[model samples]
Target: MERVEPMTLFGYEKLQAEVKNLKEVKRPRVVKDIEEALEHGDLKENAEYHAAKENQRIIDSRLAELATFLGCAKIVDPSELDHVKVSFGSTIIMTDVKTDEVFSYTIVGGSESNPDKGLISFGSPLAKQLLGKEEGDEVVIALPNSKKTFEIDEVKYQEIVFECD
Candidate 1:
């Protein structure tokens, strides 16, 4: 099996908390719902019972997944972040010379990506192109549709806090 790289301590904690919620709150709630449905009679025709059982399966699966991720997690520190250029957890600002469009994105691990909120994964095309680049540098990136060019307007080291809530 491929080894899972370490996540930030905060990220690891979030996984653990989710697992705890699944086991402590969700599982019990599902069990109660199943019992109530079963009391209603005929198991084969009981839609509520079936639905509750399905939900339980999903919750249990997620709990197992989170536990596995936590077991393999390696906490990476902010102090160890690369400062000379764009890297994971670094906020980068860039401009499209062709369109005069300016945008800023923070490079993060795959699990933390939320592009709509401007938090991009390091594995993303933009992040891959931005890595090792300094301010004022121009880079051309190949996209599935076409090629685009960007100029690095600013490069700075920024701390990232992954909050669970």
Candidate 2:
């Protein structure tokens, strides 16, 4: 089955930018490096040539991966969606019932998710349980090691910031 990738506009644009950079900047530089290395002599012992070829292979691979991601991308803009109920792109604020610790997370695409930055992928365990939950609802999530319960404090739409400030 073909996987449908649900990505925010930011994520999509980021992928596009990476592709552009690889093609326009990185690819040409590697090509030039390889050409220059070719003049240095025998291919059997040319480390520079080998290194440049390896770099070219890596760049090409990344470009192909980016192409697949872009091809399957379904750009989603949270600003246009309703925030009354939990769903993709919703920034959820919750309090851990057991520890009484509060945490906030924004549900995003797999490519956009950075748990350290509070961006959780919609496919994750926590996001799956939070999908249709509303404010004031209690949620129980099954983690790999243990189970944790949380009370939903708020659900709102905020522009996703993929990078840390």
Estimated TM-score for each candidate: 0.86, 0.91
Residue-level lDDT tens digits of model 1 in 1-165: 867654666666667778888899999999999999999999999999999999999998898777777776667764587656886667888898899999888876666677987888777887888888988899897889999898988877666655456
Which numbered prediction scores highest in TM-score against the true structure? Answer: 2
Model 2 lDDT tens row, 1-25: 7888889988888888888889999
Task: Give the alpha-carbon lDDT of every model.
Answer: 0.80, 0.91
- The true-versus-predicted C-alpha distance at residue 91 of model 2, in Å, is 0.3
* TM-score of decoy 1: 0.86
